[model samples]
Target: MKPLKTIIVMLLLLSISTYNCNAQDVKADVEKMHQLYIEMINNSNLENIDKLYTANASIRNSDATMINGLENIKNQYKATFDSGTFTISLETTDVSQLDDNHMFVSGTFVYSKTDEPKGVLKGEFVNTLKNVNGDWKILKSYRYLETTDNASIINSVYELFSKGDIPAVLALMDDEIVWNEAESNSLADGNPYIGPDAVLNGVFARIGERYKSFTLKDVKLHEMSNNQVLATLHYVLEMKNGKTYTIQAAHHWTLKDGKIVGFQQYADTKKLADSEKI
Candidate 1:
């Protein structure tokens, strides 16, 4: 009985030690994977990228497109590298360990070329890592374009406005613009002012004609939960007829290809009408 008890004690200790060793191995593997990413980036090692990605790896973008297979992944990076000397900085976040073999990580990739003079190519990305046969591999990845956080589009528009750069401001508006003035009316003549020329000549120019100069004051951005942004602003306008009026407005804007494409304007229609009553 004493010998049997000794054997059981030995077995328990061995089991406990194995469990602890495995736990440490997992932590080490995570660190190793991160280091490998850094090494690959620093070397621009397009050749060894297959070692880091799975055979059937997939990359989905925030724009809702997917890239599949190792070749595609390699090609993607190759093109980017070929285009310019890519300087990429990666940050990992939301690293949730799904299991012993699966993990999810998300972060931003601040990309800049050694040649481009403008600001950096800023964006965010998310990745799913899976451990297969003792090696961690990127099973899936997703990337998205980063845009202005606090209605910077509107700010850009206002900058052009201050300069009285009408063409620059008009270029930001869509082909179809919603004036949002008529009561419950959605017609081109009523709610919307259709076509670029109509907006340029009819709306913006008319506003300009009324004002010798206008200055937007107290611009505020209100972002809705649905990703819609309202840029609320007030401005004082000195009329060509020597009249000054305070106008409050809301510019509802939507973005596409990093530019404003769809727009809705809400403001005091009476003030606009009163000024334009020729």
Candidate 2:
């Protein structure tokens, strides 16, 4: 009886060891697939790109554009390589085993053109890979470019404003923009300021006339779903009476066609108004 019990214990240990070995093998295969993907991109060759994806794989571009199927994916790569010379570097940040035959990987990538040395673009991506037969291929790829794009547009607005380029800032807005100022704030008097002209005349002009210096500080932008962006910032308003007001503020913006179409402001109105006192 004691001999039989010892044999059973030995068998259990072997099974556990085998399971661990299989997990390690899966990890190595997944890592190899990622390396192959990077190699295909760096090579800038469409022929090798086809080998990295399944027949029905889908890819989402940074600007929220979707490419479906292997043929279209090949075309996208062909267009990119044909456009100009660029090199991409990807660093894996996280990897998760979804199942015995699937994996999820996310990482940041940096891309730069050989000619445009100063024009480097960095973006993030998430990919899902499936084990087909004995090899792994990308099943779905989502690139987080919308975040960068929306942040860029918002930053440009602030830059233009700082440079006193009101016209340029207005140009970035839609023809029929819906701009809402914080409730109870002086600017809110013209709530839902429609159009670029209305925004310039109602909001900007009023602020210029009221405050000696109106500046935004510590600004942060967050990208949300459905083409929305949220900005958290602080307002530093210097009154003509030698008084100053610092108030927390937030701005919500909705954009389309590379133009801002909607804006909503949130701020401490009472704090801003009190600064007007001598």
Candidate 3:
């Protein structure tokens, strides 16, 4: 005859096997639901959105901004669709059944506009699926969408300056700014200019006093993943000496909180020195 403890151990193993099997089934079901969601969004069919999402469903943007309720979600979706023809694909990567009433799901999504079918944007998302009325629906979604285009922000500064909007240009700089000039340049004396006022007085004022005119030409901005922007352009300067010269220059900019925090200049110094005198 088998011991009583042996029987209990056998039952426990059987129960665990059963629960694992159920978990696998749940994962499969969630993936299928996501496929249908992709179809609905791609087709712009929100007529039955209520059937898909809970009334209190909310989206948490990458920036921590929340879009609450079904109406807001619908409006955002409608706006995206109106923007252009787009197709989205989501591939389920992980699913965890937190409890009988809640499941956690995560996946990567790639969305491509019709005009450029290969792919336009790719991001990952984590979603909480809740059991409401015996139906699985997204309770909360956390996803990423880049709100700050660093290149565009820097480009706007140049555009504003070209229009003689120096105040607008100064507004883009943070309260405390660190500015540096290229070695061998006269402006390098104010290396590590501490504030916007310092930059305005030490750099802009000096340039305004010494030069007849100064502007950037053929400017192109390159972005780095680490919040740095590199702008390549020609420094079109009309020296008080009455000669106009264009020197290749590059500016390395660092930004935080949508404001410029640091700047480093690289330019042809010899040309600048020769032109300064005659």
**Alpha-carbon lDDT, every model:** 0.70, 0.84, 0.84
Model 3 weakest 10-residue run by lDDT: 113-122
lDDT of 1 by residue, 165-242 (tens): 877776665445444443321212534556557667666665666568778888888765434568888868777778
For model 3, the local distance difference test gives: 0.84
Model 3, 1-278: lDDT tens digits are 89999999999999999999998889878877887788877887776567667899999965468999999988887887787777888888899898999999998887777754322556789999999977889999998743468788799989998898887788788768889999999889989898888998999888889889998899999998778999999999998777898899999999764668999999999999977777
For model 1 the local lDDT of residue 88 reads 66
Candidate 2 lDDT over residue span 184-223, tens digit each: 8877888899999999999999889988999988999998
Stretches of candidate 1 above 4 Å error? Answer: 1-6, 42-44, 62-64, 82-134, 142-214, 218-220, 238-248, 255-278
Find the candidate with the highest lDDT and give its number. 3
Query: In angstroms, how far off is 51's CA in candidate 3?
Result: 2.9
Model 2, residue 71: distance off in Å is 0.5
Task: Please report how far candidate 3 places residue 50 from its true position, in Å.
Answer: 1.9
| TM-score per model over all chains | 0.53, 0.52, 0.57
Q: Is candidate 2 or candidate 3 better by lDDT?
A: 3
The predicted structure with the larger TM-score, 2 or 3, is: 3
Ranking of all candidate structures by their lDDT, best first: 3, 2, 1
